[model samples]
Target: MSKVILITGASRGFGKIWAEAFLKRGDRVVATGRNLAAIQDLVNEYGDRVLPIQLDVNDREACFAAVNVAKDHFGRIDVLINNAGYGLFGTVEETSEQEARDQMETNFFGVLWLTQAVLPVMRAQKSGHIIQVSSYLGLITVPVLGIYNASKFAVEGLTETLASEVKAFGINVSLLEPNGYATSWSGDSAFQTESMEIYNPVKEAFQQAASTPGFFGQPEATAEAILKLVDAAQPPLRLLLGAFAYPAVKAAYEERLASFEDWKEVSEAAHGTSIKTGN
Candidate 1:
């Protein structure tokens, strides 16, 4: 049986690629983007199988309305891919109030709003999958992308908790922590803060680090994986994509584990246990 899938940011990049992939495989797609015209081509090719809606994911009410339109049109939505977000290029100190809020609004809270909108529908039907497109930076922070890191981290926490809370309802939540992709994520789709000489070396180091061979993965390469995930009898709660994500995440987790072990005595002392915590 064909399933109905709703995807955000379907104008281009992963969203557009995944939408076409789903339509080709006989699934209905509610393809949404800020620019409605950008996705009209999908309708031109696939006709009614694709519903292109003009949507800014940050708009909470708009998110709910889009979900309703999709539910009414499709009868039921089987999967929702929250792929609408941009990278904010700035240090924690450099990120302004508005910039931080904007990053959270789209990257973090946008996921929240969409997830909230779909829960009622999924709960009533007793089945659905919510895939959140996050980044490896959510687990391992990097220089110059502080706000973006925070947003993804927030998403990780939110979606993980949602997974446990909704398991009894047959709802699955997965976080896709993709490595750096060749999509215009850092080019046109990114926002940069004002440059400061104090952080120029940090910026330089970050640039050099990102210049490693095969640092960028292709956007279309992930389409098949997503198809399998939604089709699976049991999908993972968290998934890391691309070559770079696994090793990077492994190293970050190892370092974190080492720190925790090193501070075991201090932690025990703080808990009023009889342990040596030589400060």
Candidate 2:
């Protein structure tokens, strides 16, 4: 019953907690991060049960190599948690082209590369789960995080399509859309663009909204939820974690639906009805 779970970004936050949780439940874990030192303690504590590898998700070759390492060590990988990504804070205009590309490379293309590496193995075995750690921003955007949102939105689309394509192979793909959690996600791990004086007011308001202090979800709880998801007979394609995620995502979709319906007539008018007797 003990399965091999490969987790990227296992050095800290939700990734670290999830790794520990799996270890506690007697599952084998291949924990990878850009910094080996970050996962050294886990390797020390869990010994052979944990394999800590240095991996930069943004590197395509490195992603494939890491998957090979895991497969070699564990014989097979049952779960892959794509948790390697950072928050990029800035307006679309404020973020540099390089910064935007970097964000996409890590958050979107990284997931794609890793998934591609693992799919062959899973396809041969006829069973596996791929979990993408997306964000509430994937569903709806807020100010100053457009690049980050774009990356996650890309992830959302990628994983959803992947799920449909691989269902016949017994592969389950999921997107975890977590809202604010008590993690370093907003601190050291986050990257910010050069601040513009004109956008200071908007930035200040966004910061104030984020800083409101109550009931941020804990990493451990999120880990537990993920474990439950992993054990379920049928896991969902999209899951929202944290208390804030549900209401916020629901409201966002509702508003989107309302807007679409309001414009439905105009949208339909754009295409005239085809004339009959064309045959």
For residues 1-279, write the lDDT of model 2, one tens digit per residue: 998999999999999999999998899999999888988888888899999999988899998998998998889999999999998888888999899999999999999999999999999999999999999889998999999999999999999999999999999999999998888888899998998889999999998987777647877788779889899889998899988889988998999999999998888788788446756
Query: Model 1 segments beyond 4 Å from truth?
Result: 273-279
**RMSD to truth, every model:** 3.2, 2.1
lDDT of 1 by residue, 150-233 (tens): 999999999999999999999998999999999978999899987778898999999998899889998889999999988989
Output the worst ten-in-a-row residue range by lDDT, candidate 1.
268-277
Q: Local distance difference test, per candidate? A: 0.93, 0.91
Give the number of the best model, judged by lDDT: 1
How many Å off is the CA of 118 in candidate 2?
A: 0.3
